[model samples]
Target: MNTTSKSKADTIAKLREKILLMQGFKPAGAMHKRITGLMPVEQAFPNQVFPLGAVHEMISEGPEGAAACGGFLGGLLGTLMADAGICLWISNSRSLFPPALELFGASPHRIIFADLQREKDVLWATEEALKCEGLAAVVTELNNITFAQSRRLQLVVEKSHVTAFIWRKDPVYLSNTTAVARWKIAPAPSISEPGLPGVGFPHWQVELLKVRNGIPGSWEVTWSEGRFHTHDETVRKLVSVRNDVQKTG
Candidate 1:
Protein backbone atom coordinates (compact mmCIF):
# COMPACT_ATOMS: atom_id res chain seq x y z
CA MET A 1 0.00 0.00 0.00
CA ASN A 2 1.19 3.55 -0.67
CA THR A 3 2.22 5.72 2.28
CA THR A 4 -0.67 8.13 1.68
CA SER A 5 -3.21 5.28 1.67
CA LYS A 6 -1.81 3.83 4.93
CA SER A 7 -2.05 7.24 6.56
CA LYS A 8 -5.69 7.58 5.53
CA ALA A 9 -6.51 4.15 7.03
CA ASP A 10 -4.86 5.11 10.32
CA THR A 11 -6.80 8.35 10.43
CA ILE A 12 -10.08 6.50 9.88
CA ALA A 13 -9.25 4.03 12.65
CA LYS A 14 -8.61 6.81 15.12
CA LEU A 15 -11.90 8.49 14.27
CA ARG A 16 -13.79 5.25 14.81
CA GLU A 17 -12.12 4.72 18.16
CA LYS A 18 -13.20 8.14 19.33
CA ILE A 19 -16.76 7.59 18.11
CA LEU A 20 -17.05 4.28 19.91
CA LEU A 21 -15.83 5.83 23.13
CA MET A 22 -18.38 8.59 22.78
CA GLN A 23 -21.04 5.91 22.30
CA GLY A 24 -20.08 4.37 25.67
CA PHE A 25 -17.95 1.57 24.32
CA LYS A 26 -14.69 0.43 25.88
CA PRO A 27 -11.66 -0.42 23.88
CA ALA A 28 -11.29 -4.17 23.38
CA GLY A 29 -8.21 -4.93 21.34
CA ALA A 30 -8.67 -3.36 17.89
CA MET A 31 -12.45 -3.33 18.35
CA HIS A 32 -14.92 -1.83 20.81
CA LYS A 33 -16.71 -3.92 23.44
CA ARG A 34 -19.71 -3.37 25.64
CA ILE A 35 -19.85 -4.84 29.11
CA THR A 36 -22.91 -7.05 28.93
CA GLY A 37 -23.63 -9.10 32.03
CA LEU A 38 -22.91 -12.33 30.14
CA MET A 39 -19.56 -13.03 28.55
CA PRO A 40 -20.83 -15.32 25.79
CA VAL A 41 -23.46 -12.74 25.00
CA GLU A 42 -20.81 -10.08 24.72
CA GLN A 43 -19.05 -12.20 22.13
CA ALA A 44 -22.24 -12.64 20.15
CA PHE A 45 -22.34 -8.95 19.22
CA PRO A 46 -18.88 -8.97 17.67
CA ASN A 47 -18.10 -5.28 17.18
CA GLN A 48 -21.33 -3.96 18.69
CA VAL A 49 -22.25 -5.94 21.78
CA PHE A 50 -25.13 -5.17 24.05
CA PRO A 51 -24.30 -2.30 26.38
CA LEU A 52 -25.25 -2.15 30.04
CA GLY A 53 -25.85 1.58 29.71
CA ALA A 54 -29.02 0.80 27.76
CA VAL A 55 -32.40 -0.70 28.57
CA HIS A 56 -32.96 -4.43 28.05
CA GLU A 57 -36.42 -5.94 27.84
CA MET A 58 -37.28 -9.48 28.95
CA ILE A 59 -40.59 -11.28 28.50
CA SER A 60 -42.05 -14.72 29.12
CA GLU A 61 -45.19 -16.37 27.86
CA GLY A 62 -46.36 -18.29 30.95
CA PRO A 63 -45.66 -18.84 34.61
CA GLU A 64 -42.84 -21.28 34.02
CA GLY A 65 -41.29 -18.91 31.52
CA ALA A 66 -41.50 -16.10 34.02
CA ALA A 67 -39.61 -18.22 36.53
CA ALA A 68 -36.81 -18.67 34.04
CA CYS A 69 -36.66 -14.96 33.30
CA GLY A 70 -36.44 -14.17 37.00
CA GLY A 71 -33.70 -16.74 37.47
CA PHE A 72 -31.64 -15.27 34.65
CA LEU A 73 -32.08 -11.75 35.95
CA GLY A 74 -30.71 -12.84 39.31
CA GLY A 75 -27.49 -13.92 37.64
CA LEU A 76 -27.40 -10.73 35.58
CA LEU A 77 -27.62 -8.68 38.75
CA GLY A 78 -24.84 -10.69 40.32
CA THR A 79 -22.56 -9.78 37.44
CA LEU A 80 -23.29 -6.04 37.70
CA MET A 81 -22.91 -5.91 41.49
CA ALA A 82 -19.28 -7.04 41.36
CA ASP A 83 -18.28 -3.35 41.54
CA ALA A 84 -20.09 -2.99 44.88
CA GLY A 85 -22.81 -0.53 43.93
CA ILE A 86 -26.43 -0.14 45.00
CA CYS A 87 -29.14 -1.59 42.69
CA LEU A 88 -32.75 -0.55 42.63
CA TRP A 89 -35.51 -3.11 42.02
CA ILE A 90 -38.98 -1.68 41.40
CA SER A 91 -41.94 -3.97 40.93
CA ASN A 92 -45.67 -3.90 41.35
CA SER A 93 -45.38 -6.76 43.84
CA ARG A 94 -42.84 -9.24 45.08
CA SER A 95 -42.67 -12.61 43.42
CA LEU A 96 -39.45 -14.32 44.35
CA PHE A 97 -38.22 -14.61 47.91
CA PRO A 98 -35.36 -12.23 48.65
CA PRO A 99 -33.22 -14.99 50.15
CA ALA A 100 -33.09 -16.83 46.82
CA LEU A 101 -30.64 -14.21 45.52
CA GLU A 102 -27.97 -15.27 48.02
CA LEU A 103 -26.84 -18.04 45.70
CA PHE A 104 -26.08 -15.47 42.98
CA GLY A 105 -23.66 -13.46 45.18
CA ALA A 106 -26.01 -10.52 45.69
CA SER A 107 -26.81 -9.91 49.30
CA PRO A 108 -30.33 -8.67 49.96
CA HIS A 109 -28.86 -5.74 51.90
CA ARG A 110 -27.31 -4.32 48.75
CA ILE A 111 -30.65 -4.10 46.94
CA ILE A 112 -33.21 -1.39 47.45
CA PHE A 113 -36.64 -2.96 46.88
CA ALA A 114 -39.57 -0.69 46.12
CA ASP A 115 -43.16 -1.84 45.73
CA LEU A 116 -45.02 0.54 43.48
CA GLN A 117 -48.62 -0.66 43.27
CA ARG A 118 -49.98 1.51 40.52
CA GLU A 119 -48.83 1.13 36.95
CA LYS A 120 -48.07 4.81 36.63
CA ASP A 121 -46.05 4.75 39.80
CA VAL A 122 -44.00 1.81 38.61
CA LEU A 123 -43.13 3.51 35.32
CA TRP A 124 -42.31 6.77 37.01
CA ALA A 125 -40.14 5.14 39.62
CA THR A 126 -38.29 3.09 37.01
CA GLU A 127 -37.48 6.18 34.98
CA GLU A 128 -36.37 8.10 38.04
CA ALA A 129 -34.13 5.33 39.33
CA LEU A 130 -32.47 4.83 35.93
CA LYS A 131 -31.50 8.50 35.79
CA CYS A 132 -29.28 8.15 38.84
CA GLU A 133 -25.75 7.45 37.63
CA GLY A 134 -24.69 6.59 41.16
CA LEU A 135 -26.72 3.37 41.13
CA ALA A 136 -25.22 0.27 39.60
CA ALA A 137 -28.37 -0.93 37.81
CA VAL A 138 -32.13 -0.54 37.85
CA VAL A 139 -34.68 -3.37 37.46
CA THR A 140 -38.39 -2.95 37.08
CA GLU A 141 -41.41 -5.21 36.44
CA LEU A 142 -44.28 -3.79 34.47
CA ASN A 143 -47.20 -5.01 32.33
CA ASN A 144 -46.64 -2.76 29.32
CA ILE A 145 -44.11 -0.28 28.01
CA THR A 146 -44.72 1.35 24.65
CA PHE A 147 -41.95 2.22 22.23
CA ALA A 148 -42.08 5.85 23.30
CA GLN A 149 -41.75 5.01 26.95
CA SER A 150 -38.84 2.68 26.24
CA ARG A 151 -37.11 5.39 24.20
CA ARG A 152 -37.42 7.70 27.17
CA LEU A 153 -35.83 5.10 29.42
CA GLN A 154 -33.04 4.65 26.90
CA LEU A 155 -32.30 8.38 26.87
CA VAL A 156 -31.91 8.44 30.63
CA VAL A 157 -29.67 5.37 30.69
CA GLU A 158 -27.55 6.79 27.89
CA LYS A 159 -26.98 10.02 29.80
CA SER A 160 -26.42 8.40 33.20
CA HIS A 161 -24.60 5.35 31.83
CA VAL A 162 -26.75 3.11 34.02
CA THR A 163 -28.22 -0.24 33.00
CA ALA A 164 -31.94 -0.90 33.11
CA PHE A 165 -33.64 -4.29 33.18
CA ILE A 166 -37.36 -4.53 32.43
CA TRP A 167 -39.30 -7.70 33.24
CA ARG A 168 -42.68 -7.87 31.54
CA LYS A 169 -45.08 -10.24 33.27
CA ASP A 170 -48.18 -11.48 31.48
CA PRO A 171 -47.78 -8.89 28.83
CA VAL A 172 -50.77 -8.37 26.57
CA TYR A 173 -48.60 -7.91 23.51
CA LEU A 174 -44.97 -7.76 22.47
CA SER A 175 -43.42 -5.14 20.25
CA ASN A 176 -40.17 -3.49 19.27
CA THR A 177 -38.50 -0.90 21.47
CA THR A 178 -35.37 1.20 21.71
CA ALA A 179 -33.79 -1.29 24.08
CA VAL A 180 -30.42 -2.69 23.12
CA ALA A 181 -31.84 -6.21 23.40
CA ARG A 182 -35.03 -8.12 24.11
CA TRP A 183 -35.04 -11.63 25.52
CA LYS A 184 -37.32 -14.57 26.15
CA ILE A 185 -36.43 -17.18 28.73
CA ALA A 186 -38.16 -20.47 29.44
CA PRO A 187 -37.40 -22.91 32.23
CA ALA A 188 -35.55 -25.96 31.02
CA PRO A 189 -35.20 -29.22 32.90
CA SER A 190 -32.88 -28.98 35.85
CA ILE A 191 -29.56 -30.79 35.77
CA SER A 192 -29.36 -33.42 38.49
CA GLU A 193 -26.24 -33.50 40.56
CA PRO A 194 -24.12 -36.64 40.34
CA GLY A 195 -24.64 -39.03 43.27
CA LEU A 196 -27.48 -36.91 44.62
CA PRO A 197 -31.21 -37.59 44.73
CA GLY A 198 -32.43 -34.01 44.39
CA VAL A 199 -32.12 -31.63 41.43
CA GLY A 200 -28.75 -29.94 41.00
CA PHE A 201 -29.07 -26.53 39.36
CA PRO A 202 -31.72 -24.43 37.69
CA HIS A 203 -31.53 -24.27 33.89
CA TRP A 204 -33.23 -22.09 31.29
CA GLN A 205 -33.49 -21.77 27.52
CA VAL A 206 -32.42 -18.20 26.70
CA GLU A 207 -33.46 -16.80 23.33
CA LEU A 208 -32.13 -13.42 22.40
CA LEU A 209 -35.07 -12.56 20.21
CA LYS A 210 -33.85 -9.10 19.32
CA VAL A 211 -30.60 -7.20 19.71
CA ARG A 212 -30.19 -3.81 18.08
CA ASN A 213 -26.49 -3.98 17.30
CA GLY A 214 -25.69 -7.61 18.00
CA ILE A 215 -26.49 -11.15 16.95
CA PRO A 216 -29.65 -12.83 18.19
CA GLY A 217 -29.06 -16.22 19.79
CA SER A 218 -30.24 -18.96 22.11
CA TRP A 219 -28.55 -21.05 24.79
CA GLU A 220 -29.22 -23.27 27.76
CA VAL A 221 -27.82 -21.43 30.78
CA THR A 222 -27.59 -22.77 34.31
CA TRP A 223 -26.89 -21.09 37.61
CA SER A 224 -24.28 -22.79 39.72
CA GLU A 225 -21.33 -21.60 41.79
CA GLY A 226 -22.74 -18.08 41.85
CA ARG A 227 -22.50 -17.53 38.07
CA PHE A 228 -24.08 -18.40 34.73
CA HIS A 229 -22.56 -21.17 32.66
CA THR A 230 -23.91 -21.77 29.16
CA HIS A 231 -24.13 -25.41 28.20
CA ASP A 232 -22.37 -26.52 25.03
CA GLU A 233 -25.66 -26.40 23.14
CA THR A 234 -24.26 -25.11 19.85
CA VAL A 235 -25.18 -21.44 20.34
CA ARG A 236 -27.94 -20.73 17.76
CA LYS A 237 -27.41 -17.20 16.57
CA LEU A 238 -28.37 -14.70 13.87
CA VAL A 239 -27.01 -11.43 12.53
CA SER A 240 -30.06 -9.26 13.47
CA VAL A 241 -33.56 -9.69 14.71
CA ARG A 242 -44.23 -12.67 27.62
CA ASN A 243 -45.99 -14.08 30.52
CA ASP A 244 -48.48 -15.15 33.22
CA VAL A 245 -48.60 -14.65 36.96
CA GLN A 246 -47.79 -17.52 39.44
CA LYS A 247 -44.41 -17.78 37.63
CA THR A 248 -42.87 -20.38 39.91
CA GLY A 249 -46.03 -22.06 41.05
Candidate 2:
Protein backbone atom coordinates (compact mmCIF):
# COMPACT_ATOMS: atom_id res chain seq x y z
CA MET A 1 0.00 0.00 0.00
CA ASN A 2 1.03 3.57 -0.70
CA THR A 3 1.71 6.02 2.15
CA THR A 4 -1.44 7.98 1.31
CA SER A 5 -3.65 4.85 1.48
CA LYS A 6 -2.11 3.71 4.73
CA SER A 7 -2.61 7.13 6.29
CA LYS A 8 -6.28 7.24 5.24
CA ALA A 9 -6.91 3.80 6.72
CA ASP A 10 -5.41 4.82 10.03
CA THR A 11 -7.42 8.03 10.13
CA ILE A 12 -10.69 6.15 9.53
CA ALA A 13 -9.96 3.72 12.34
CA LYS A 14 -9.27 6.59 14.76
CA LEU A 15 -12.47 8.37 13.75
CA ARG A 16 -14.56 5.23 14.31
CA GLU A 17 -13.06 4.70 17.75
CA LYS A 18 -13.62 8.36 18.61
CA ILE A 19 -17.31 8.04 17.75
CA LEU A 20 -17.64 4.99 19.99
CA LEU A 21 -16.26 6.94 22.96
CA MET A 22 -18.51 9.92 22.24
CA GLN A 23 -21.51 7.58 22.36
CA GLY A 24 -20.45 6.18 25.81
CA PHE A 25 -18.92 2.91 24.68
CA LYS A 26 -15.55 2.08 26.22
CA PRO A 27 -12.50 3.03 24.22
CA ALA A 28 -9.39 0.91 24.14
CA GLY A 29 -7.37 3.83 25.60
CA ALA A 30 -9.72 5.29 28.24
CA MET A 31 -10.57 1.75 29.48
CA HIS A 32 -13.37 1.31 32.05
CA LYS A 33 -14.16 0.60 35.69
CA ARG A 34 -12.58 -2.39 37.41
CA ILE A 35 -14.62 -5.03 39.23
CA THR A 36 -13.58 -6.39 42.62
CA GLY A 37 -12.46 -9.98 43.38
CA LEU A 38 -11.06 -10.60 39.90
CA MET A 39 -7.45 -10.33 41.01
CA PRO A 40 -5.65 -12.34 38.34
CA VAL A 41 -7.80 -10.90 35.54
CA GLU A 42 -6.72 -7.39 36.44
CA GLN A 43 -3.25 -8.10 35.12
CA ALA A 44 -4.67 -9.53 31.89
CA PHE A 45 -6.50 -6.37 30.86
CA PRO A 46 -4.99 -3.18 29.57
CA ASN A 47 -3.75 -0.59 32.13
CA GLN A 48 -3.96 -3.33 34.77
CA VAL A 49 -7.70 -2.81 35.08
CA PHE A 50 -10.81 -4.87 34.31
CA PRO A 51 -13.91 -3.48 32.59
CA LEU A 52 -17.20 -3.70 34.42
CA GLY A 53 -20.79 -3.19 33.14
CA ALA A 54 -19.93 -5.01 29.95
CA VAL A 55 -21.20 -8.29 28.54
CA HIS A 56 -18.78 -11.22 28.90
CA GLU A 57 -18.83 -14.66 27.28
CA MET A 58 -17.80 -18.19 28.24
CA ILE A 59 -17.64 -21.13 25.83
CA SER A 60 -17.18 -24.82 26.43
CA GLU A 61 -17.11 -27.95 24.29
CA GLY A 62 -18.56 -30.72 26.41
CA PRO A 63 -20.42 -31.53 29.63
CA GLU A 64 -17.22 -31.44 31.62
CA GLY A 65 -16.29 -28.16 29.99
CA ALA A 66 -19.71 -26.68 30.68
CA ALA A 67 -19.51 -27.70 34.32
CA ALA A 68 -16.07 -26.13 34.62
CA CYS A 69 -17.31 -22.93 33.05
CA GLY A 70 -20.28 -22.81 35.40
CA GLY A 71 -18.03 -23.34 38.38
CA PHE A 72 -15.84 -20.40 37.43
CA LEU A 73 -18.81 -18.10 36.83
CA GLY A 74 -20.42 -19.17 40.09
CA GLY A 75 -17.29 -18.19 41.99
CA LEU A 76 -17.14 -14.92 40.09
CA LEU A 77 -20.76 -14.09 40.80
CA GLY A 78 -20.22 -14.61 44.53
CA THR A 79 -17.89 -11.64 44.59
CA LEU A 80 -19.82 -9.61 42.00
CA MET A 81 -23.14 -9.94 43.79
CA ALA A 82 -22.02 -9.31 47.38
CA ASP A 83 -22.98 -5.63 47.27
CA ALA A 84 -25.56 -5.62 44.50
CA GLY A 85 -27.88 -8.01 46.35
CA ILE A 86 -30.09 -9.54 43.64
CA CYS A 87 -28.94 -11.49 40.59
CA LEU A 88 -30.87 -13.18 37.76
CA TRP A 89 -29.66 -16.43 36.23
CA ILE A 90 -31.33 -17.55 32.97
CA SER A 91 -30.57 -20.92 31.47
CA ASN A 92 -32.18 -24.02 30.00
CA SER A 93 -29.69 -26.23 31.79
CA ARG A 94 -31.78 -27.75 34.60
CA SER A 95 -28.60 -29.34 35.76
CA LEU A 96 -27.41 -25.96 37.05
CA PHE A 97 -28.68 -26.26 40.59
CA PRO A 98 -28.95 -23.06 42.60
CA PRO A 99 -27.54 -24.83 45.61
CA ALA A 100 -24.34 -25.37 43.62
CA LEU A 101 -23.88 -21.61 43.32
CA GLU A 102 -23.88 -21.46 47.12
CA LEU A 103 -20.65 -23.40 47.07
CA PHE A 104 -19.24 -20.12 45.86
CA GLY A 105 -20.45 -16.99 47.64
CA ALA A 106 -23.78 -16.18 45.95
CA SER A 107 -26.65 -17.72 47.86
CA PRO A 108 -29.58 -19.28 45.97
CA HIS A 109 -31.96 -16.81 47.57
CA ARG A 110 -30.13 -13.87 46.10
CA ILE A 111 -30.38 -15.38 42.62
CA ILE A 112 -33.56 -15.63 40.52
CA PHE A 113 -33.21 -18.45 38.03
CA ALA A 114 -35.34 -18.32 34.86
CA ASP A 115 -35.76 -21.64 33.12
CA LEU A 116 -36.50 -20.71 29.54
CA GLN A 117 -37.04 -23.51 27.04
CA ARG A 118 -36.39 -21.83 23.72
CA GLU A 119 -33.33 -19.83 22.60
CA LYS A 120 -35.43 -16.84 21.66
CA ASP A 121 -37.13 -16.83 25.04
CA VAL A 122 -33.77 -16.97 26.82
CA LEU A 123 -32.39 -14.07 24.82
CA TRP A 124 -35.54 -12.06 25.32
CA ALA A 125 -35.50 -12.72 29.02
CA THR A 126 -31.83 -11.85 29.30
CA GLU A 127 -32.29 -8.53 27.52
CA GLU A 128 -35.15 -7.59 29.82
CA ALA A 129 -33.08 -8.58 32.82
CA LEU A 130 -30.23 -6.37 31.68
CA LYS A 131 -32.61 -3.43 31.55
CA CYS A 132 -33.26 -3.66 35.26
CA GLU A 133 -31.07 -1.34 37.30
CA GLY A 134 -32.00 -3.09 40.53
CA LEU A 135 -30.31 -6.34 39.58
CA ALA A 136 -26.62 -6.81 40.18
CA ALA A 137 -26.10 -9.14 37.23
CA VAL A 138 -27.79 -11.36 34.62
CA VAL A 139 -26.44 -14.71 33.40
CA THR A 140 -27.74 -16.58 30.34
CA GLU A 141 -26.83 -19.83 28.64
CA LEU A 142 -27.19 -20.22 24.89
CA ASN A 143 -25.61 -21.84 21.87
CA ASN A 144 -24.87 -18.60 19.98
CA ILE A 145 -25.61 -14.93 19.60
CA THR A 146 -25.63 -12.63 16.62
CA PHE A 147 -23.85 -9.30 16.42
CA ALA A 148 -27.21 -7.53 16.34
CA GLN A 149 -28.55 -9.27 19.47
CA SER A 150 -25.34 -8.57 21.35
CA ARG A 151 -25.46 -4.91 20.30
CA ARG A 152 -28.99 -4.56 21.69
CA LEU A 153 -27.86 -6.05 25.02
CA GLN A 154 -24.83 -3.81 25.04
CA LEU A 155 -26.92 -0.70 24.59
CA VAL A 156 -29.31 -1.68 27.36
CA VAL A 157 -26.53 -2.57 29.82
CA GLU A 158 -24.81 0.72 29.11
CA LYS A 159 -27.86 2.62 30.25
CA SER A 160 -28.77 0.33 33.17
CA HIS A 161 -25.18 -0.32 34.34
CA VAL A 162 -25.92 -4.01 34.72
CA THR A 163 -23.35 -6.64 33.86
CA ALA A 164 -24.28 -9.68 31.76
CA PHE A 165 -22.58 -13.05 31.39
CA ILE A 166 -23.49 -15.19 28.36
CA TRP A 167 -22.43 -18.82 28.50
CA ARG A 168 -22.40 -20.67 25.16
CA LYS A 169 -21.94 -24.37 25.68
CA ASP A 170 -20.50 -27.06 23.37
CA PRO A 171 -19.58 -24.70 20.58
CA VAL A 172 -15.99 -23.84 19.80
CA TYR A 173 -17.42 -21.80 16.90
CA LEU A 174 -16.53 -18.16 17.24
CA SER A 175 -18.72 -15.37 15.90
CA ASN A 176 -18.72 -11.60 15.90
CA THR A 177 -20.49 -9.98 18.82
CA THR A 178 -20.55 -6.78 20.86
CA ALA A 179 -19.50 -8.47 24.13
CA VAL A 180 -16.62 -6.77 25.91
CA ALA A 181 -14.88 -10.07 26.50
CA ARG A 182 -15.00 -13.76 25.52
CA TRP A 183 -13.46 -16.61 27.50
CA LYS A 184 -13.03 -20.36 27.14
CA ILE A 185 -13.33 -22.40 30.34
CA ALA A 186 -12.21 -25.99 30.74
CA PRO A 187 -11.62 -28.13 33.81
CA ALA A 188 -8.11 -28.52 35.12
CA PRO A 189 -6.97 -31.04 37.70
CA SER A 190 -6.82 -29.56 41.16
CA ILE A 191 -4.20 -30.05 43.84
CA SER A 192 -5.52 -30.10 47.39
CA GLU A 193 -4.31 -27.22 49.49
CA PRO A 194 -4.06 -29.20 52.77
CA GLY A 195 -2.60 -32.33 51.12
CA LEU A 196 -5.93 -34.06 51.62
CA PRO A 197 -6.95 -37.12 49.58
CA GLY A 198 -10.10 -35.51 48.17
CA VAL A 199 -10.70 -32.77 45.57
CA GLY A 200 -9.77 -29.24 46.53
CA PHE A 201 -11.38 -26.02 45.29
CA PRO A 202 -12.31 -26.08 41.61
CA HIS A 203 -9.56 -25.37 39.09
CA TRP A 204 -9.93 -24.15 35.49
CA GLN A 205 -7.93 -23.09 32.49
CA VAL A 206 -9.52 -19.70 31.80
CA GLU A 207 -8.58 -18.34 28.41
CA LEU A 208 -9.50 -14.76 27.75
CA LEU A 209 -9.86 -15.24 24.03
CA LYS A 210 -11.13 -11.73 23.30
CA VAL A 211 -11.56 -8.46 25.13
CA ARG A 212 -13.00 -5.45 23.42
CA ASN A 213 -10.96 -2.30 24.00
CA GLY A 214 -8.51 -4.37 26.05
CA ILE A 215 -6.52 -7.60 25.62
CA PRO A 216 -6.79 -11.40 25.62
CA GLY A 217 -5.26 -13.82 28.16
CA SER A 218 -4.55 -17.46 28.97
CA TRP A 219 -4.68 -18.30 32.67
CA GLU A 220 -4.53 -21.53 34.61
CA VAL A 221 -6.38 -20.52 37.76
CA THR A 222 -8.03 -21.94 40.83
CA TRP A 223 -11.22 -20.68 42.51
CA SER A 224 -10.52 -20.03 46.16
CA GLU A 225 -11.17 -17.23 48.64
CA GLY A 226 -14.24 -16.39 46.54
CA ARG A 227 -12.11 -15.29 43.55
CA PHE A 228 -9.66 -16.51 40.96
CA HIS A 229 -5.95 -17.03 41.62
CA THR A 230 -3.23 -17.59 39.08
CA HIS A 231 -1.90 -21.11 38.74
CA ASP A 232 0.75 -20.23 36.15
CA GLU A 233 2.24 -16.76 35.80
CA THR A 234 4.26 -17.63 32.74
CA VAL A 235 1.64 -17.43 29.96
CA ARG A 236 -0.64 -14.43 29.37
CA LYS A 237 -2.28 -12.28 26.67
CA LEU A 238 -3.69 -15.13 24.55
CA VAL A 239 -5.68 -14.86 21.31
CA SER A 240 -5.33 -14.97 17.53
CA VAL A 241 -1.78 -13.64 17.75
CA ARG A 242 -0.40 -16.85 19.10
CA ASN A 243 -2.49 -18.94 16.72
CA ASP A 244 -1.34 -17.02 13.67
CA VAL A 245 2.28 -17.32 14.74
CA GLN A 246 1.97 -21.08 15.03
CA LYS A 247 0.34 -21.39 11.62
CA THR A 248 3.10 -19.46 9.87
CA GLY A 249 6.14 -20.79 11.72
- Clashing residue pairs in all predictions, respectively, total 4, 0
Q: Estimate each model's TM-score.
A: 0.80, 0.77
Which runs in model 2 stand beyond 4 Å of their true positions? 1-37, 232-249
**For residues 72-179, what per-residue lDDT tens digits would candidate 2 score against the true structure?**
888777767877578898987756767888877788889988998888999999999999988878889888888899999999988887889999997656789988
Relative to the true structure, candidate 2 reaches a TM of 0.77
CA lDDT, every model vs. true structure: 0.76, 0.77
Q: Per-prediction RMSD in angstroms?
A: 7.2, 7.5
Residue 14: error of model 2 in Å?
14
Cα lDDT tens digits for candidate 1, 1-249 = 699999999999898778767766655653323333356766665354556677888888677887778778878877677668788999986686778776777766899999878989998998899888889789898869999999899888878888899988878988778887788888876665434567668888888888764689987777877677776533222101001112432
lDDT of 1: 0.76
Look at candidate 1 and give me any clashing residue pairs.
59-242, 60-242, 61-242, 170-243
Residue 207 Cα positional deviation in candidate 1, in Å, after optimal superposition: 1.1
In terms of lDDT, the best-performing candidate is 2
Residue 137 lDDT in candidate 2: 81
Pick the TM-score winner: 1
